[model samples]
Structure formats: structure tokens, C-alpha cells
Target: MEVRHKQATIDKLTHENATLKRLKFAAGREHFNAEQRRLLEDTLDADLQAVAWWC
Candidate 1:
């Protein structure tokens, strides 16, 4: 893959990882409703699909 493409992908994945982590932490603290937690987990798993190797 092209370096630019890879870099961009990595950057996007990093941003998403940060967002999901924040969501997970907030959810763990009971900030998210049950439905919200389910959605967050699903989205987080989907986001991880972009960089499964890194994980």
C-alpha cells in the first residue's frame, strides 16, 4: 500500500481508537445507557476492523 494511504489509515484508526476508549471509559463509569453501551461496543469492534494487525 502507498505510504500516504497507510498513514492516513493509521491516523484515522488512531482517532477512532481514542474515541472508542473514551466511550468505553465513560460507559464503564455508567455514563452510557445499556443501549448506548451496546452501540459503542459494536462501533468499536467495527473500527478495529480497519487495523486488526495493529491490535
Candidate 2:
């Protein structure tokens, strides 16, 4: 059903956001610089916003 599909989408987005947060906060990772960190945070925010809209 449409409701179930929307719920699935929201769940997926939530998991993605959580993973991103874990990555962003993990210590000793030299790959991401300050700018990249900001970008990642922005993306996580956007994902959360989309989830909110779905709700």
C-alpha cells in the first residue's frame, strides 16, 4: 500500500542519516576535511527534512 511504501522510504532515510552521523563523528579519520564534514552534515539535515515531510 501507499502508506507502507512511504514508511519504508522514511525508515531507509533515517538509517542513512544515522550512518552519516556515525561517520561524521568517528575519530581518527583523515579522509574528510572541515568542508567535507559540513557538506555531510548538510546532507544529513536534508535527509531528515525529507523524512519529516514524509511523516
Candidate 3:
């Protein structure tokens, strides 16, 4: 990927990862049901992979 595109992907994935982390771990907001949490976990894994590629 081009540098600019890669950077953009990384930024997006980083933001997603942070959001997921908050949703998964934040106090008083652990509203994810079991299935929803599972999906978020999967998405977080993908986000980590995407950010790792750019890094």
C-alpha cells in the first residue's frame, strides 16, 4: 500500500481498537452481551492486525 493509504488505515484501525477497548473494559459501560463482546473481540483482533501491518 502507498504510505498515505497505509497511514490512514493504521489511524482508522487504531481508533477502532481504542473504541473497542473502552467498550470492552470501561466501567459502568460494559453493555456488550456475550455475542456482542465476542464480535468486538474478533474485530479488535482484526484492528490489531491492520495496525501492525502499517507499523
Model 3 lDDT, residue 49, Cα = 80
Candidate 2: tens digits of C-alpha lDDT, residues 1-55: 9989888987888698678767957756557779987898798778778777776
Question: Which candidate do you rate higher for TM-score, 1 or 2?
Answer: 1
In model 1, where do residues sit more than 4 Å from their true spots?
24-30, 53-55
lDDT of 3 by residue, 1-55 (tens): 5988877986897798678668757847556678987897898888778677766
Query: Distance from true position, residue 31, model 3, in Å?
Result: 1.8
Model 3, residue 48: displacement in angstroms?
Answer: 0.8
lDDT of 1 by residue, 1-55 (tens): 5887788777988888789678768665757778977897798777777577544
- Taking all chains together, each candidate's TM-score versus the true structure is 0.64, 0.61, 0.59
**Candidate 3, lDDT over the whole model:** 0.77
Candidate 3: stretches off by over 4 Å: 1-6
Question: What ordering of candidates by lDDT runs from best to worst?
Answer: 2, 3, 1
Model 2 is weakest, by summed lDDT over 10 consecutive residues, at 24-33
Question: What are the Cα lDDT values of the candidates?
Answer: 0.76, 0.79, 0.77
In model 2, what lDDT does residue 22 have? 76
- TM-score pick, better of 1 and 3: 1
The lDDT, on a scale of 0 to 1, for candidate 1 is: 0.76
- After aligning candidate 2 to the native by TM-score, how far in Å is the CA of 5 from where it should be? 2.1
